[model samples]
Target chain A: MRLIELQRRMAADVMRPLSSRAPGVSTYLTPNTLLTAADRLDIYHRQYWLRLLDALAEDFPALRALLGERAFSNLSKAYLASCPSKSFTLRDLGSKLPSWLKADLGRAGKYGALALELARLEWAHVEAFDAAWIPPLDSAALASGPDLRPTLQPCLRLLELSHPADEIRLAANQGTLRREKLSVGTHPAGKYFIAVHRLDGDVFYRRLEAGEFQLLRRLERGLSLGESLAGRIRGLNDPETAPSKLRTWFEAWTVLGWLGE
Target chain B: MPANKFNGFTDLGIGVGLRIPHYDHIFSQAPAVDWFEIISENFMVDGGRPLAVLDRILEQYRVVQHGVSMYFGSAGRLNREHLRRLKSLVRRTKTPWLTDHLCWGSVDGKYTHDLLPIPYTFEAAKITARKIREARDFLEVPIAVENVSSYAEFKMSQMTEWEFLGEVVERADCGVLLDVNNIYVSSRNHGFDPMAYLSAVDPARVAQFHIAGHSQFEKYTLDTHDHPVIDPVWALYAEAVARCGRTATLLEWDDRIPPFEEVHAEARKAEKYLPEAAAECA
Candidate 1:
C-alpha cells in the first residue's frame, strides 16, 4: 500500500472503538514473539486516543462535568471524529468543541445551550491564559486621565454568558460539582458578563454588571474613553445602569488594570 | 566533552525535561539543572504563560528544542505555519539544534496528533530524507531526527530500523538524537538486538542521548517516559556513550513526574556511564 494510504488507514485504526476488529492491521503490522499483531498495534492505538482524550478532558472540565463522565467521553469521541486535532499543540484540541456542541447536542440536548456557553468560556480561559502578552497601558498613561481611549491587555477576555456557567466552572475546578445534578433545564441559571484574565501568572475571573460589561466590551473594541462611557451613560434611563454607576465602575476597572493600564 | 560533529553542538550535561509540576520549584529554587529539553510544540504558542515561563527558564539555563509534531515523513507540503512558529522559537531560545521523531504523524490535512511510525523501506527513506533536507535548508540549523518506539512493523520494510535511520540522516546530511530508551523499548517490542541497533548508527551523526523509562505489559513495553531509567536502558546509554564518546543527554519524565530534585538525580545517573564524569570524580 502507498504511504499516505497506509497512514490514513492506521489513523483510522487507532481511533477505532476498542470492540472493533482493529482495522487495517494485516500486511503492515507484524505479530511479534510476545504480542499478536492486533495486540501490538493496540498499544499505539490506545496511547493515541487516550492522550488526546486526556487533553480534551483537561481543557473543558465544566462541559465534561455538565455532561457527566460517560456522556462527555462519548461527546469528545464524536467531537474528535468531526474535528480531529489539526494544530501541533494539544492546546488547540478543543478549538472546535463549542461549535461542535452547538451543532450536535448529542445526549445533552436540553443542556445544549448551557454546555455550549460553558465550553466557550472554558476555551476563552485557555486562550487568555497564555495569549501573547500586550503590555497594558502604562500607569502614567492610565493616570493621565479618564479621557484615555480604552484598549484591552492581550491577556484579557470579556465574555457575556447565560446560565452563570462560571459558577459551575468554579465548582468543577474546586471539585465540589456533582455531575449528577447538572443540566440545562434544572441547573443554576442566570445572565453573567464575566472577565477572565491572567494576573501574576495565574488565571482569575470576576463577574461584571450589564453596564460594566458593555463599557468594557466597547473599550475592548478600541472605542474612546468618552465614547464607551457615553454609550453606557445612554443606558442611564434604566435604574440598573444609571449615570452614578459609571464613575464607580471606572475606578474599579482602572484599579483592576482592566482599563489597559 | 566531545564536540558534536554538526555545528559543534555542545554536550549539555545531564538534564531533565522542563515539566509544569516542577515549574514552581524550578523558578523559585533555581535548582542546579544542567539544561532542559522542552517538547517544542508546547512552547510554540503565541505569547502565553508557556512562552513566558520558557523565556524565564532560558535566561538561567541551557534549553534545547525537541518537537513531536514535525511529521517529517508525512506526505505532501510541510506545514509552513508550523515551521514559522518553530523558527520564531528557535530565534528566541537560540537552541543549538532542533529535533523531532522520524515518522509520519498526519495524513492529508488531518493530524493524528501522536507519533505514528513510518516504513523502513528504501522508498520511504528516499522520500523522508528529501523532506529532512528541505526542513534543514529552511530552518538554517542542525536538525536531528529521532527514532520513535514502535508497536507495529511494516511488512515491506526492506531494511532494519537502524539501516533506515542511517539512510535518512546520511541522505539529509542531518544529526541523530539517538534516544537510548526508545531503542530498548522498540527492541523488546520488535524482537531485535539493542546492541546491534546501537552499533549500526553512525557515531558522528549522534548529537544527543535521551534516557527515559518504559512500562512493561504482559506482552510489550510502552515508552511511557514516566519512570526511572531501568538498568537495561542505562546499560544501553553506556554503550551509546562508549560509541559516541561524550554526547548531550536528557531524561524525560512526562508522566507522574516526581519532585525537581528527584528528576534531576535521575538525569544525573547517566554520569556513571560517562568517562568525563569518571575522570572528574577521579
Candidate 2:
C-alpha cells in the first residue's frame, strides 16, 4: 500500500469510535506471537481516545464536574468524534468546545444553559491563562486626555454569562463543590459579567457591574472614550453619578493592569 | 568519541524532565542538577505561566527542548504556524539541539496527537527525512529524531525499524535522540534483539539519550514512563553509552512523578553507566 493511503487507513482505524467494532486491522498490520494485529491496533485506538479525553478533562474540569464523569466522557467522545483536533498542540483541543456546546445544547439536557455558561467560562480561563501579554497603559498614560485611546489587555477575557459559572469553577478548584449539590434550585438564573484576566503569571476572575461590563466591552470592541460612554450604559440608571463610577472602574482597571494602549 | 557534528557535541550529564509537580521544589530548593529536558510543546504558548516558569528555569539551568508533536512522518507540508512558534521558543531557550519523534501523529490536518508508527518503506523514509531537513533548516537548529515505542508494525514495511531510522537520519543529515527505553519497549513488543537496534545506529550522530520506564501487559510493553528505569532498560542505556559515547542523558518520568529529590536521584543513576563513556568524551 502507498504511504499516505496506509496512514489514512491507520488513522481512521485508530480514530474509530471505541464503542464501534474494531476496523479491519489485519489487512494493514502485521501480527506477532503474543498479540494479533487486532490486539496491537487496539492499543493505539485506546491511546488515541485516552490521550484526547485526558487533555480535555484537564482543560475543562469545571465542565466535567457539572456534567459528572460519565456524561462528560460521552460529551467528550462525541465532541472529539465531531471535532477532532486540527491544531498542532493539544492546548487547542478545547478551542471550539464552547461553540460546540452551544450548538449541541440538547445533549446537555437539564444542565444545558449552566453547562454552556461553564464551558464558555472555562474556555475563557484557558485563553486568559496563556493569551499574549502586553504592557499596560499606566495611570500617567490615561491622564493624557487628548491622546487617551485605551484598549483591553490581550490576556483579559470579558464574558457575559447567564449563570455564576465562575463561582462553581472556583468551588470545583477549592474542592468544595459537590456534584450532588448542583441543581437549578441551588443556582437560580442570574446574569453575570466576569472579567477573566492574567496578572503576574496567574489567572484571576473579577465580577463586573453591568455598567463596568458595558464600558469594558465597548473599550474591548475598540470604542474610543467618547463612544464608550456616549450612550447610556444599559444598567447605569443614574447618569449624574456615571462619571465617578466610570472613573472608579477605570482606576481599578488601570491598577489591575487590564488596560493597554 | 562520536563526532555529533550536530552541535559540537556537549555531554550534559544526568538530567530529568522538567515537570510541573516539582516546580515549587525546583524554585525554592534550587538543587544542583546538570540540566533539564523540557517538552517543547508545553512551553509553545503565546504567554503566561508556562513561559513564566520557563524563564525562571532558563535563568538557573541549561534546558534542552524535546518535542513530541513534530510528526515528521506525517504526510503534507509542516504546519507553518507550529514552526513559527517553535522557532520563537528555540530563540528563547537557545537550545543546543531540538528533538522530536520520528513518527507521524496527524493526517489530513486532524491531529491524532498520539505518535503513530510509520510504514518503514523507502518512500516513507524519503518523505520523513525531507520534513526533518526542512524543519532543521527553518528552525536553524540541530534536529534529532527520537524513535517512538510503537505497538503495531505495517505490512508494507520494506526494512527493519533500525534500518529505516538510519535511512531517515542519514538522508536528513540529522542527529539522533536515541531513547534506549523505547528500544527496549519496541524490542519486547516486536521480538527483535534490542542490541541489534542499538548497534545499527551511527554513534557519531547520537546527540542525546533518553532513559524511561514502561509497563508490561500480557501482550505488549507500553511506554508508560511512570516507573523507575527497569534493569533491562538500564542495560540498554549502558550499551548505548558504550557505543555512542557519553551523550546527553535525560530520565523521563511523566506520570506518578515523585518528589524532586527522588526524581533527581533516579536520573543521577546514569552516572553508573557513563563512567567509561564519560572518560572517552573527556
Candidate 3:
C-alpha cells in the first residue's frame, strides 16, 4: 500500500477504542524483544486520545461537570472521532467542540441546550482569552469627533449564547460559589448577549442588553458610528428612550478598549 | 570545534526551549542564557500575549524556530497557511535556520498531532525530499528535519533508522537536527548500538543537535522531555558532538519544568560534552 494509506490505517488503529485488546499487529509493524508489534503501536494510540481528552476536559470543565466524568469522556471521544484535530496546535483542538455539542444526537433538544451553551461559553473564553490586544478608543478622540469608527480589540469576543454560561465559569474560577454535588446537566436555559474582553491580562465578561449587543455586533462588522446607532435604534426595547442607553453602552464599550481604528 | 558545514549558520552554544512556565522570569529577570528556541506553531496566531512576549524575548535572545507540525512526509499538499505563518515568524525572529520532525502527522486532512514514524523506503524518501526542498525555497530560509523517538518500527522499513534519516536529508539536501536523546531512546527501545546509529550520518549535513530526557519503563523508553539528561544520553551527546562539531544544541524540557535556574542549569549540562561549549563555560 502507499505511504498515505499506511498512515491513515495506523492513525485509525491508534485511535481505536481502548476496550479491545492491542490491535492485531499490523503486518507492517516489526516485533521487538521487549514489546510485541501490537503492544508498541498501542502506546501511541493511548497517548494520542488521552492527551486530547485531557485537553478537552481542561478547556470545558463545566461541560464535564454537567455531563459527569464518564459521559464527558465518552462524548468527547465521539466528538473527537468526528472532529479529529486539524490545527497545528492543540489550542485549537476544541475549536469545533461547541458545534459538535450542538450536533450531538443525545443532546441538542430543549433539555440539552444548557449543556450546549456551557460548551459554547467555555470555547469563547478560550478564544477571547488570547485574542488580539488593541488599545481602547482614545478618550480624547471620542470627545472630539462624532465620525469615529472605533474598532474592537482583537481579544474581544461577542457571544450570543442560549444560557448564562458565564455564571458557571465565573463561579468556578473564583472558587467562591459551588454546590456540594452540582447535578449533571441540570440548569435553566436563558438567553445572553455577553461581551467577553481581556483587561490587564485577565478576561472579563459584561452582560449586554438586546440593543447593546446589536450595536456591538454592528460595530464589529465595520459599521460606522451613525449606522450602528441607526441599527440599534430600531432593535431597542424602548426606541424613544434608547438615545441615552446608546450613549451609555457606547461610552462603556469605548472605555473598555474594545476598538482599534 | 570546527564550524558546521552549513553556511552562515554558526555554533550557537547551548540553548533552552522557551517555555511558558519561565515567561515571568524571562521577562522580569531577563535571565542570561545562550539562546531560546520556541515551538513555531504556538506563536503563529495574529495577536496575543504570546506574540507580545515573543517580540520582547526576540529583542533580548537569539531565538530559533523549532516546529512540531510540518508533517513533511504527509500524502498531502504543504499547508500553505501554516507555511505563511511560519515564514512570518522566521522574518520576525530572523532565525538563522528552521527545523521540524521528519515524519507525517496528518492523513486525509485530519491531524493526529504526533511525531509518527515512517517506512525507510526509496519512494518515501523521494517524495519527502521534494516537500522539504519546496519548504526551504518558499520559506526563504534553510530548513532541517528532526528524528523522533518511536515505540514501534515498520517491518516494511528497508533500511535502519540512521540510514533512513541520512537518506532523507541527503536527498532533500537539507540539514539535520540530530536529537541525541532520541537516538538513545530508540537505541534502547529497538536494541541497537547508539554508536552505530551516530556513525551512519554525514556529519557535515547536521546543522544542530538536541539533548533531552526521557521516561524509562521496564520494557521500553519513551522520549518524555521532562527529566534531566541521564548519563548514557549525555555520553551519546558527547559522541554526536565529536562527529557533528559545535553544532547549535538545544535542550528541551517540556513537562514538569523546573525554575529558570534549574532548566538553564540542565541545558548547561550539554557544555561538558561539547568542547567549545565547555571552553565557553570556563
Candidate 4:
C-alpha cells in the first residue's frame, strides 16, 4: 500500500471502535500466510490508545486518585473514544479536555468542574516544563516603553472556576474528601479565581481576588503598566493609595520571574 | 560554551538510565558511574530542578542522549522544531551521538507517540535510510537508530526485520543502537530467532546496546522496562558484546525505577562482557 493509504487506514483504525478498523501494510510482517491482517492491525490499534490512556492516568495521579480508579479509568476510556488525539505529541493530548468537560456537562455530571480544574492544572504543569524562559524584563525597558515578548512561555495560565478546585484537589490527595457524593449541578458558594505560574522549576498556583485576576488578565493582554492600573483602579476615592498595591504585585512577580521587560 | 567538547568515550564503559528516584544518592554518594544515559525529552526544557540535578551528574560523569520521538521513519517531513531542540540539548550536554528508535511514528502527520513498527520492505527501507541520511546531515553528527519491540507484524513486509535494519544503517551510513532486550521481546512476539537478528547487524555500525526487562502476559511479552535485566537478555547482551566488541551499553528501567544501587548493579553486570579496561585513547 502507498504511505498515504496506510496512514489513512491507521488513522481510521486509531479513531474507530476496536472491532471495525482495517489492517493495512505494516513493516514487521508479511501479508496473509499466517495471522490475519485484521488481527495484526488490532494489536497496534489497541496499543496506541492504551499507551496514551495509561500515560494520561500516570500524569494526572491526583485527579485519578480523587475520582477513584474505576471512575477515572472509565472516564479516560470515554475521553479517548470521544477525542482521538490529533497531535503527534502526547503532551498535547489534554489540551481539549477542559473545554470538553465544559461542553459535556451531562457526561461529566457531578465531576464536570473537577474534571475541568484537573485538566487546567495538568496543562499548566506541562506548559511550565516546556515554556520558554525569558530573562527578567529590563527595568530600563519597562520604564521607557511598551512591548511584551510575543514568544513568551505559554506557562502563565489564568483559571476562573466556579468551585474551590484547588482546595478540593488538595483534600482529595490527603484522603480527607470523598468523591462519591460530589455534585456538579450546583456551583460552589463563592467565586474562585486562580493564577498558575512556574517558579524555580516547579508549577505553583495562588488563589486570586476578583480584582487581582482582572488586573493580571489586562496585563497579559499587553496593556502598559500605567494603562493597566488605570483600567482597574478607576473610580477609587484615593487613586494615590494604589501605588503600594502595585509595588507589592511587582515584587511578587519579580520573585516568580514572570516579569520580562 | 567551551566549543562543546566531544572527546568521544574516554574508557567510560557501559552505563545505565539515570532515573529521577536515584538522583540524590547518585550525586551525594558519588557512585562509581562512568557514564549516564538520559532520555532526551525528559531534560529538553529550560532551567529546572532536572537540569540543575543533571548539571551535578554531568560534573562527574559522561552523558549521552537517547530519544524516543525522532520518528525518523515517518513519511512526513522532518520535525525541524524537534531537531532544533535536540541540537540545542546535544550542545548543552556535549553528547557524542543522539539516538532514537528505527521505526516510523506517523504517516502524513500524526504521531502515534509509540514506536510503531514499520514494514521490512525495500520501499520502507529506502525511505527510512534516506531520512536517516538527511537527519545526520542536518544534525552534523551520527544518528543511531534502535530497534523496538513489537506485538504484531505487517503481512506486506518483504524481508526480515534484521535485514531491513542492516540495509537502512548501511545505506544511510548511520550507526545502530542494538537493543538486546527488544530483540528478545520481538523474538517472542513474532516467533523469530533472536540470534539471527543479532548476527545480521553490522558490528562496525553498532554504536551502543540496550538491555531492559519486560513483562510477560499470557501470549506475549511487553517491553515495559519495569524490572532488572532478565537472565536471557543478559545472555544475549553477552553474545552481542562478544560479537560487537565493547560498545556503550545502557540499562533502561523507566517504570517502577529502583534505587541507584540496583540500577548500578544491572549496569555492572554488563562489565564482564566489555573488553578489559584500557587506557583513555581519546
Candidate 5:
C-alpha cells in the first residue's frame, strides 16, 4: 500500500469509537508472538480516546460535574465523533464543545440548559485564561479624559447566562457540589451576569449587575462612550439610580483594570 | 565531528520538562538546574498566563523548545499557521535547536495528538525530509527529529526503523535526537536488537539523548514515562553516550509527576553515563 493510504487507514482505525467493531488491521499490520495485529492497533485506539477524554475532562470540569461521569463520557464520545480536532494543539480540542452541546439537545437530555450554561462558562474560562492582554486604562488616564471610550479588555469575557454557572462551577471545583444530590429542575435559575477576566496571570470571575453586563457587552462591540450611554443598554430597573450605579461600576472596573482597547 | 558539531548546537547538559506542577517550586526555590525543555505548543499562545510564566522562566534559566505536533511525516501540506506560531515562540525561547517526533499524527487537517509511526519507505522518507527542510529554513533554527516509541509497524515498510531514520536525517541535512528508551521499547516490540539500532545511528548526527521510563505490560512495554528509568535502558544510555560522546540529555516524566527534586534527581543520574570530563564540567 502507498504511505498515504496506509496512514489514512491507520488513523481511521485508531479514531474509531471503542464500542464499534475494530478496524481490519491484519492486511496492513504485522502480528508478533505476544500480540496480534488487532491487539497492537487497539493500543493506539485506546490511547486516542483516553488522551482526548482526559483533556476534555480537564477543560470542562464543571460540565463533567453537572452531567455525571458516565453521561459526560457518553456526551464526549458523541462530540468527538462529530468534531474530531482540526487544530494542531490539544488546547483547541474543546473549542467547539459549547456549540455542540447547544446544537445537540437530544443527547443532553433533561439537563440541556444547565449543561450548556456550564459548558459555556468552562469554555469562556479556557479563553479567558490565555486570551491576549491589552494594557488597561489607568486611573490617571481615566481622570484626565472624561470622554474616554469604555473599551473592554481583550481578556475579558462578558457572560449573560440563565443558570448560576459561576456558583455551580466554584462549588463543583471545591468538591461541595455532587451530581447525585443535584437536580437541574430544582436548581435556582435566573438572569446571571458575570465577567470572566485575567489579572496578574491568574483568571478570575466577578458577578456584575444587569446594567453593567449590558454596558460591557456594548463596549466590547466597539461602542463609543456617547453611544453606550444613549439608551443602548437596557435591564436597569431604576432610571433614577442609573448615574450613581454607573459611577460605582466604572470605579470598580477601573480599579480592576477591565477597560482596555 | 563532536556531538555539539552535529548541528553547531551546544550540549545543554541534563534537563527536565518545564511542567506546570513545578511552577511554584521553580519560581520560588530557584534551584540549580542546567536547563529546562518546554513543550513548544504549550506556550504557543496569543498572550496571557502561559506567556507571562514563560517570560519569567526565561528570565531565570536556559530553556530549549521541544515540540510534539510538527507531523512532518504526513503527506499533506504543512500548516502555515502552525509554523507561524511556532516561529513566534522560537524567537521567544531562542532555543538553540528545536526537536519534534519523527512520526505522522495528522491527515489532511485533523490531528491525532499522538505520535503515530511512519512506514519506512523511500517515498515517505523523501516527503518527510522535504517538510523538515522547509521548516528548518522557515524557522531559521537547527531541527532534530526524535524517534518515537510505537506499537504498530507497517508490513510494507522497506527498511528497519534505524535505516529509515538515517535516510531521512541524511536527506534533510538535520540532526537526530536519539531516544534510547524508544529504541528499547521498539526493539522489544518488533524483535530487533537495541544495540544494532544504536550501531546503525551516525554518532556525528546525534544531537541529544532522551531517557525515559516505560510501563511493562503483559503483552508489550508502553512508553508511559511515569516511572523511573529501568536498568537496561540506563545501560543502553551508557552505550549511546559512549558512541555519541557527550550530548544534551533530558528526562521525560509527563504522567504522575513527582516533586521537582525527585525528577531532577532522576535527570541527574545521566551524569554518570556521560564522559568523565563532561560529567565534571556539567
Candidate 6:
C-alpha cells in the first residue's frame, strides 16, 4: 500500500476501540496476546489518546479538577475521539476544546461555560508560552504612525463568556472549589470578559469591561488606533483632546507591550 | 571520512533536558551543569517567558536544540516555514546541531500530534533518508534524527528498526541521537531485544544519547518521562556509550517534573558511565 494509505489505516486501527463494537477494519493479528498486532496497534492508539488527554489535563488542571477524575476522563475521551488531534505536537490538542465544550454535546448548561472558560484559559497559557514572541512595538515607531504589523505574536487571545470565568477558574485551580456542584445543568447568570497574554515570561489574564474588550478585539483584528477608538470615545471625544480616557488606555497598553507597530 | 572527523559537539560534554521547573535554580543559583538540552518547540514562539528564560539560559550556558515536531519521515513535504523558524532559532542560539524524531508525525498534511512509527521497509527507508538529506542541505547544518518509542510494528516491514535506522543515517549522511530509553520501551512493546537494536546502530553516526524513564502497564510499556531513569535503561545506556564511545548524553523528564536539583542529579548519574565526562569536569 502507499505510505499514506498505510498511515491512515494505522491511525484508524489505533483509534478504534478494542471491544466488538468497533467498526470493521483490517486487522493483521488478534487482540488476545501482548504481541498480537491488534493489541500492539491498540496500545499505540490508546497511548496516543491517553498521552494527549493526560497532557491536556495537565494543562487544564482546573477543568480536570473541577470535573472530577471519572467525568474528566470520559469527557476527554469523547472529545479526543471526536476531534482526533490535528497538530504535530501534543500542545495543540486542546485548541478546540473550549469551543467544543460550549457546543451542543459539550454544553452542559450549569458547568458548560466554566469548563470552556477554563479550557480557554489553559489553552491561552500554552499559547503564551509557545507562541512566537514579537519584541513589543517600539514606542517611537508607533508614536509616528498608526500601522500595525501583521506578524504580531499570535499568542494573545481574548475570551468572552457568560459566567464569571476568571474567578471560577481561579477557584478551580486553588482546589477550594467542589466538583460535586458543577453538574451539567447548573449555570450562573452574567457575562464575563478576559484577556490572556504573555508579559515578561509570565502568562496573565485580567478581567475586561465589555467596551474595553470590544476595543481590544478591534485592535487585535488589525484595526488602527484611530479606527478602533473612533466610535468608542465618549462626550467631547476627538483624536487629540476629547478622548482622554481612550488615550490613557492606549498608553497603558503600549507600556504593557501589547500594542504592535 | 573518519568517524572522529564527523563527531560534532564533542566539547558539549554531558547535559540534561533543560526543563522549566529548573529555570530558577539554574538561573539564580547557577548550578554546576556542563550544558543544557532544550526542546526546540518550547522556544519556537515569537515572544514569551519560555523564550525569555531560554535567552537568559543561553547567555549563561551551552544550549542545543532538540525538536519533537519535525516529523522527518512523513511523506508530505517538509514545512519550510517551520524550517525557517528553526534556522532562525539556530542562528539566535548558535546551536551546534538540531535534532528531531525519526518518525512520521503527519500524513497527507494532517498532523496526528504523536510520533507515529514508520514501516521498516526499504522503500520507507529510502524516502525517509532522502527527506533527511533535503532537510540537512536546506538548513546548511547537520540534523540528528532520534529513534522514537513505538508500540506497533508494520506487518509489511522487511527489516528490523535498527537496520532501517542505520541505513537511513548512512544514506542521508546525517547523525543519530540514539534515544536509549526509546529502544528499551519499543523493545518491551514489540518483544524485541534492545541489545540487538543498539548493536545494529552505527556508533560512528551517533551524535547524541537520550536517557529517560518509561511507565509500564500490564500489557506494554509506555515512554513517559515522568520518573527517574530505570536501572535497566541506564545499563543499556552504559552499553551504548561503550559502543558509541563518548557522545553528548541528555536526561529528559517531562511530566510531574521534580525540583531542578533532583533532575540535575539524575543527569549527573550518567557521569559514572562516562570517564571522559568525569575527567573533563575533574
Scored by DockQ, the top model is 2
The superposed Cα distance between candidate 3 and the true structure at residue B72, in angstroms, equals 0.9
lDDT by residue (A49-118, candidate 4, tens digit) is 7788787886666667667788777777777677766565576777676677678755555666667777
lDDT of candidates 1 onward, in order: 0.81, 0.89, 0.81, 0.73, 0.88, 0.75
DockQ of 3: 0.69
- Local accuracy of candidate 4 as per-residue lDDT tens digits, B9-91: 33356788888888879868998887899988777666556677778888888898988887777767778877787777888
Cα error, candidate 4, residue A131 (Å): 2.1
The root-mean-square deviation over C-alpha atoms between each candidate and the true structure, in angstroms, is 2.9, 1.5, 3.0, 4.4, 2.2, 4.4
Candidate 1 whole-model C-alpha lDDT, 0 to 1: 0.81
| Model 1: DockQ vs. true structure | 0.65
**Candidate 3, overall lDDT?**
0.81
Alpha-carbon shift of residue A202 in model 4 (angstroms): 2.0
Q: List the residue pairs that clash in candidate 3.
A: A132-A155, A136-A257, A151-A259, A151-A260, A152-A258, A152-A259, A153-A258
Q: What's the residue-level lDDT of A143 in candidate 5?
A: 58
How would you encode candidate 6's per-residue C-alpha lDDT over B116-213 as one tens digit per residue? 88888888788898888887787776788899998766667888889889888888888988899999998887778999999888877888889998
Measured as a fraction from 0 to 1, the native contacts recovered by model 4 come to: 0.40
User: DockQ of candidates 1 onward, in order?
Assistant: 0.65, 0.86, 0.69, 0.42, 0.82, 0.42
Rank the candidate models, highest lDDT first: 2, 5, 1, 3, 6, 4
Q: What ranking emerges by TM-score with the best candidate at the front?
A: 2, 5, 1, 3, 4, 6
**For each predicted model, how many residue pairs clash, with residues at least 3 apart or on different chains?**
3, 0, 7, 8, 0, 12
Query: For every model shown, what is its TM-score relative to the native structure?
Result: 0.92, 0.97, 0.92, 0.87, 0.96, 0.84
Which parts of model 6 have CA positions greater than 4 angstroms off? A17-34, A61-71, A98-156, A178-188, A221-224, A232-244, B1-9, B188-193, B215-219, B226-235, B276-282
- Report the lDDT of model 6 for residue A251: 70
The CA lDDT at A174 in model 5 is: 98
DockQ-based class of model 3: medium
Q: Give the clashing pairs for model 5.
A: none
Summarize candidate 5's per-residue lDDT along B1-282 as a digit string, tens digits. 234644455867899999999999999999899999999999999888899999999998898899999999998878999999999999999998899999999996889899999999999999999999999999999999999998988889999999999999999999999999999999889899999999999988888889999998998989999999999999999888888778889999999999999999999999987876355445
Indicate the residue-level lDDT of B226 in model 3. 91
lDDT of 6 by residue, A29-68 (tens): 2333455565566666666666677777888888777777
